[model samples]
Target: MWLPNKNEKKKSIASIANDFIGDGEAIFCDSSTTCMHLVPYLIKKQNLIIITNGLHIATSLSERSDAKIYICGGHIYNSSGSVLGSSASEFISNFRADIAFISCEGISKNGIYMSNDEQAQIKEKIITQARETILLCDSSKVNKESYYKLCGYNNIDTIITDKKPEKNSFLVNTDIELLYPVE
Candidate 1:
C-alpha cells in the first residue's frame, strides 16, 4: 500500500476536527502533529477551553480566536515542545473533559501506542476522564506496534485516517466510527 504524503494526511485532520469540537466543549488535545492541525477548526469557536501539553497547539492559535487555553504544567520536552512528567499527568487528570483528541506511533490488536511512556500516561489519564475519545492517525500506522500502549480500540469512540484499510483489517471489525477525508 502506498503511504500518503504529508499534505494528504493533513487534509483529514480538519474533517475529524469538525466532528470533535462543539462550540463550548472542553477538550484535551494531545501533543501530536495530527492534533496540532485542530488549530484552524477552533478559530471560530466560543467558550472553548483547550487544555494541552502540546506547546504548538497552545501557541499557534491567534489571540483573536476567543478560545481560552491552558498549558499543562510540567517538564517541557524541548525537542517536541510538549509538557510531560508526573506533574503534568496529575494536573491533566484533575479535569474531566468532554473529549480528547490523540494520536499514537502505532495501532494493533493490543492497542494504540506511542513512543513516550510519559505522554502515554498522560493520554491514558485523559482517556479515563474524558466523555469520549477520538483518535487521529494516518493509515500507515495501522497494524504497526509501538513501545507503549496509549489505549485500546475499546477505548476509542472514533478514528480518522487518510487511508482505507482492507476488509480484514482490525479497524473494519471494530465498532468505532471511522472518518476519512471526502477526497
Candidate 2:
C-alpha cells in the first residue's frame, strides 16, 4: 500500500474534483479527509446533496444548511476511518449519482488500485451507479500497484493531480483527462 505525501494529496484531490464536477449536481465521495475538502468548493449550489460514509465529513456538512448529507451505514474499519460492508454496498448500489469522486492508495499503468477488498467492493458499486467516476490522487501514487484492483485507467473518467505525467505515461493511452492544480 502506497501512502501519498499529505500536502500534495490534498492539492491533487481538489484539482480533480474542481475540474470534473459541475454546478448543482449530486456527488458521491470517499471518506478520505482530503477528498472531503473538495465538497465545499465543488458544490456550487445550495441544493447540492453530498453522499459519503465519513463521519467527519457528515458532521462538517451538517452545519451547512445549503447541503443535504446522507450517511452510508455499515461495518467500520476503525484503523482506516472508513465504512464498508454489505449494507454500505447496497446503499451505494441504489444511489444514482452524477459523479462518484474517489481516492485510492495507489494507481498503476493498468488502473486504479486499493489496499482492501471490502473498500474495493464498495467502490465498484459506486462506480456502476454513478454517471461518471473521477479519481483524486497525487502524483506520488502514480505507477504504484496495490492488492485490490478497483478498475483500469479506462474506467476512470478523469484524474486530478498536482503534477502532470510524461506525455507517453500509461495513463495517456487510457484517455483519462488529467487536471493539474493552478499554481
Candidate 2's C-alpha lDDT?
0.75
lDDT of 1 by residue, 130-182 (tens): 89998888888988988887877889999888867777887888889987766
Per-residue alpha-carbon lDDT of candidate 2 for residues 64-180, written as tens digits (9 for 90 to 100): 537777879898888555788999888877678998888887888777898888888888888888889888887888899998998887677888776767879876666778777
Shift of residue 67 alpha carbon in model 1, Å: 1.0
Highest TM-score scorer: 1
Task: State TM-scores per candidate.
Answer: 0.91, 0.87
Candidate 2 residue pairs in backbone clash = none
Alpha-carbon error at 155 in model 1, in Å? 1.3
Q: Give lDDT: candidate 1, residue 29.
A: 88
